[model samples]
Target: MDDQSPPRKGCCSLRCGLALLLHFCNVSMMSQRACLSLTMVAMVNATDAQGLPNASTQEPPGDLRNPVYNWSPKIQGLILSSITYGMLVAQVPVGYLSGIYPIKNMVGSGLLLSSLLSLLLPLAAGAGASLVLACRVAQGLSQGTVLVAQHTVWTRWAPPAERGRLTSMSLSGLMLGPSVALFATGHICQALGWPVVFYIFGACGCALSLSWFVLFYDDPKDHPCISLGEKELITASLPEQVGSGGKSVPIKAVLTSLPVWAISLSCFAYSWTNHIMFLYLPTFISYRLRVDVRENGLLSALPHLCSWLLSILAGHAADGLLARKRLSLIAIRKLFTTLGLLLPALLVMGLLYLGSGFRGTLSLLTLTSATLGFCTAGMMINPLDIAPRYYGFLKGLTILIGMTGGLTSSTLAGIILNQDPVSSWFKIFFLMAAINVTSLVFYLIFAKAEIQDWATEKQHTRL
Candidate 1:
C-alpha cells in the first residue's frame, strides 16, 4: 500500500482539513504565549523607580521636609528599600511554589497583584508608615513570585548552548529594571509628585498580567507559535528540566550536594556586600559626602549599571569558553568567582580607608560595581550545573540563602551605626569585605560545575 498515494477524494479532503486545523491551533497558542511572556518581562522590568518619570522630583513645599536637612532624601531611600525587605521574606516560598506549580500561572498572578499594589502606593504613602509598609510588602510578594517563576519559564524555552547568554539576560533585568526606573523616575518626579511613579508601575503591571494569561505556554511542546525544528532544538537542549519530566525533584538529595552549599554560601557573601552598597549608599552620600538627592540617586545607580553591562560581556565569555572547550567549567567558574569576590573585597576596604574626602572614592566605587559582574559567571550559572533538572528549586535555594545577606547587612548597619547612617558605613564595609574574602577562599576550594556520578546515574535511569 502506497501511503502517499492519493486516497479516496472525500477521505483525502478530510485529512487535509484536520491537519490545517491543528496547525492553526498551534500557531494561535504560540502567538498568544509569546505576547504574554514579553508583557510579563516588561512588567517585571518596569515596576521600579527607574520606570517612573517623577521619581526624583522635589517635594511639595508643605510636605514633610526635615527641618535641619531635606526629609525627601530619607523618605525616598527608605521607602524604596521597604519593598526589598518584604521580598526577603517571600523568596523561599515563591521558589518552592515554582517547583511544584505551573510557573506561568504563578508569574501571571504576581504581575496582576503587583500592578494592583503599585496603584495603591501613592495612597499608602499619603496614609502613613503602616499603610506604606503594607503596600511595600505586597509589592515584595509580587516581585519574589515573578522573579523565581520567570527563571523556571526560561529553563523550558531556552537551549543549553544559549543558556549562559539567556541566563545573563534574564538576571540582568534586575539591573536593567532599576536603571530604567531611575531614569524614568527622575524625569517624572521632576514634572509630577511621587504618586505618578506608582501609577506608571500599576498600569504596566495590569497590562502585563493580561498579556501573560493570553500569551504564555508552559513548555516548548505546549507553545503554539514555535516551529517543529525550534521546539525540537529547545527540548533537546533542556536537561532534566523541572516540568517536562512530570516527576518531583528530590529536595533532600539536592540539599545534600556539597557544591550546592558552596554556591549558596558564595551567593550570600556576594549579596551582603552588594545589598549594603545598594540600600544605604544614598544615605551615605547625602549625609557623609554632602551630595544632594538628585546627584546621589544617579551616583548610587552607577554600580548596578556597570554590573549590567559587564554581565552581558560575561555571558558571551562563558559561551566562548564552552564552545571552544578551552577550559573545564571549574576553571571558568574559579577565575570569575575569584575575581568577583576578591576585587570587590579590596575595593570595599579601599572605600572604607579612603573616607569621605578621598579623591578616588567615586572611581573606586565604580570599580566595585563593575567587579560584581565577575561573579555572574560562577554563582549565576551554578544551578544549571548541579541540577539542570531542578533549576527552579536549586536556584531558589541559592537565592533563599543568598537573600539572608540582605537582612544580616541591614541589621549590622543598624547596630554598628546606632542608626546614625553616616558614622557606621566604614565599619560595615570593612566587615563585609572580610566576609567576602573568606567566602571566596571556600568557594575556590569546594565549588564545581560538573554534576557528580550519582546525578548522572540517576538521570540515565530516568531515561
Candidate 2:
C-alpha cells in the first residue's frame, strides 16, 4: 500500500496500452467539442475585414454552396455552451452507471453516439442555429459519459505508484484535442468548407470507438490478450476494495465531504478559465490582433499544445517526487495545484497591460495554459487518491459542479462581449484571476490526498 515504492519495468504492459487508447478516446471526444470554436468563424456570415461579425452591421446569406449563417455573438455563445448543458444532465447518471457496468461498453457507446451526432452537425447547422444547438446538446450528452468513464477505467487498471503518469498521459488528450482540432479546423474550413471539419472528425471518432470496443477491457482479468505478468502486476497493485462486487455509494457522506467540495471548487475555477481560452481565444485573436483564419488557428492552438506537452511532463515529475518520498501526497497535490492556478492568474492579469503586442500576448496565454496543465497532477486526479472505489461517481459529481463554470463563463463572456467586444476583455480576464485565487485558497485548505473513511466503509444497500 506504500505508493512510494519504485515502479516495476514493462512500459509496454496492457495497462499502458489502455492508457494509450484512453488518450485517443479523449482526443476524439475533445476534437468533437473543439472543432466548432474555429469552425464557427467560417460558419457565420457578415464578417468585417478582421473576420469577426460586424457588431454594427448585420447581413444576409451570400452563397448557398459554402453556406454561412448570421448568428449573433449571443447566439454563438449559446451554441458553444449548449454542450455543457447536456453534459450536466448526463454526467451523474453515467458516472453511477460506470461503477455498476462494464466501462468498455459505457465509454464505447458514448463515443459512438457522439460520433454519429458529429456527422449530423453540418446538417443541423444548415437547418438553423436552433437545430445546431440541439445537435450540440445531444453530442454533449453522449460525451458526458467519457470523462467519468475514464476515471472508472483507471480505478481498475492504474496502480497507485504509476497513477500520476498513466492518468496524466491519458488526460493530455483533453488539451491535445483542442490543439489539433483548432489547428486543423481552420485549414479544413478554408479549403473544403466548415462542414468537412465535422465529417472528418466524425469519421475519426467512429474509427476510435471501433478500436476501443475491440481492444479495451474493463478489468485486466477480463482482457484475453493480456500477459500473465502484466495482469498480475495490475491486479496486485490495485486496492482490495476496488472492483470488489458493487455496494451502494454513500451519497450523503460524499455530498457533505469538504474534500469533495474542495475538488469541485477547484474544478469550477479550472473549467472556467479553460473554457474561456479554448472557446473564445480564436475570437479574441481575430478581434484584437486582426489575424486571418489560418493565423488565428495557429495562434490559438499554441497555448493548448504547450499545455498538453507540459501536462505529460508534470505527470512524470509528480510521480517521480512521490516515488522518491520527496513530498507528502497532500503537499504534492497542493504544490502543483498552486502552480497550476496561481501562475496562470498572474499571467492573465499581465495581459491587461500588454497593449496589442502580439508576441507578449501569445506568450502570456501560452504560459497560462502550460501552467494550468499542472492541475492534472493536482485536484484533477485527487478523486482516485481519496476514493479509488467510487472515483467515477465522485468525478461525476465534481464535474457536474465544475462544468457549470464552463456554462457560466461562456454565456457570461458572450453577454459581456455583447456589450463591447474589444474593451470588455478586461472584465473577463480580471474575473478569471479572482476566481482562480479564491478557489486555490479553498482547495489548499480542504483538499485531502488520503483515502476517506466512507470510501472504505461497506454499505449493503444496493442502487
Candidate 3:
C-alpha cells in the first residue's frame, strides 16, 4: 500500500468513524456558538421606534418569560464579537501545542471546559453584560482548539485521495451546528426558557468530551480497536514526512509561504460573510421581515442546513474529479474556490434589492451559503495538501488570522446597525461582496495545491 494505491473498500472504516466523531465535536462547538445569536433576541427587552423600552411589543411564540436586559446595540455587538477575541489569542498556541500533545486530551478537555462555561452563561447574563462578555470569551478560547485539532487529526487519518470527503464531512458540522442550534434555540427558549438552551448544549459537550477520551487516539497506530488493514491504509496513504511523526515547525518558511497567506486571506473573506450570517441573520429576519421568533429560527436555519448538505456533496465531487483525473489538484481547488467566493459575492449583493420579500431573500441567502460549501473542497482543505506534516501549526496560524474577520465583521456590523438597523444593512452587504471579490483574486494569484518543498523532511532537517 502506498499513496498511489487504489481506494480502500468498506463503509465501516475507522477513519470514517474518526470523521464522524469529529463531526459531532464540531456540531457541539457550533451549537454553543450559535445559541447566543437567537437567545439574545429573547434576552433583550423589546425596544420601540424611539429606542425606548416598549412593553406593548408582542412576545414571540413559546415565551419562556425570562428576564430581559436593555443592552444597547454596541454592547450586544461586543458580546457577540467577544468569542472571536478569545479565539484570536488561543489559535496559534493551541495549533502549535496540537503537534506536541495528545490531541484527544487537548480537544476533549477544551470541549469539556467550554461546556462547563456554557452552563454558567445564563448566570453570567443575569449578573451583567460585562460578565456575559467574559463568559463568551472563555467559551471561545476553549472552542478554538477544536478546529485546529480537527485538521491535525486528518493529517494522520485521511489518505490523500479521501482527504476531500473526510475533511468535508467533518467540517460540515460547522454548518450543522448553526442549523440545529438556530432551529432548536427558539423553540427551546419558548418552551423551557432561554437558560435551557445553554444547559442542554453544555451537557452535550460534556458527554462528547467523555466519548472523545474513550474512543479517540492521536494516531491510527495507537488506536486499540482499528483493524490492521484500515491502519495500514491510513498510514500508507499519508506522505512520508507526515508518517515520520511530528517535527519542530519550520517557522521562517511558514511565515514566508504565499500559499499559506492565500489560504488565510480566503479564510478571512469566508469568515466575514459567515460570521455575519451566523450571528446576525436572525436579527435581520426579525428587523427586516418582522418575523416571529419561531419563523426566525426556521429561516435562519435554512441557509446553514443547505450549506451543510452542499459541503458533503462538493467534497465528494472534488474527490470524484481527482479519481477520474479530469483536472489537476490545483485546478480543482481554484475552480471550487471560485464557485464558493464568486457566487456568494453575487448573491449577497442580490440581498440589497430584495427589500422585505422573505422568500426571495431566503432563496439568495440559501444559495449563497450553499455555494460556500465548495470551499470545503478548496482552500479549506488546502492546508493539508500543501503541508500535511505542519497542518496543526498552519491551520492554527491561518485560522487565527482568519478569525479576525469574524471580529471585524461583528464589530463593524454592530456599529453599522446601531446607526439605523434598516438602512445600515445595505452597507454590510456591499462590503461583504467587496471583500469576497478581493480575497478571491488574491487566492487565484497565489494559491497552490502541491506539497511545498519546505514541508519535506529534508528541508525541515536543513532548517
Models 1 onward score TM values of: 0.78, 0.94, 0.94
Q: Per-residue error at 47 for model 1, in Å?
A: 28
Per-residue lDDT of candidate 2, residues 17-103 (tens digit): 788888988998999999888887777742732336544343335544457776876688788889999999988887887888888
Which 10 successive residues of model 3 have the least lDDT summed? 1-10
Between 1 and 2, whose lDDT is larger? 2
At residue 445, what lDDT does model 3 achieve?
99
Name the runs in model 2 displaced over 4 angstroms.
1-10, 46-65, 459-463
lDDT of 3 at 415: 79
Q: Write model 1 residue lDDT over 60-129, tens digit each, in one string.
A: 3234321011223234335445665766777766766676788768877877787787677556645665
lDDT of 3 by residue, 1-463 (tens): 3433443453477788878888998999999999888887777744632256634345543344576777776677788889888889889988888878878898998899999999999889878999999998898889898777768888788888888999899999999999999999989988887899999999999999899999999888888877777778878776453532356678888989999999999999999989888888888877777877778899999999999999998899999999999999999999989999899999988888765586888798788877888899999999888887778888898898889997899888887877866679899989999999999999999999988998876765523
Global lDDT for candidate 3? 0.84
Q: Which sequence of candidate numbers ranks them by lDDT, best first? A: 2, 3, 1
Model 1 accuracy (lDDT, Cα): 0.61
Give the alpha-carbon lDDT of every model.
0.61, 0.85, 0.84
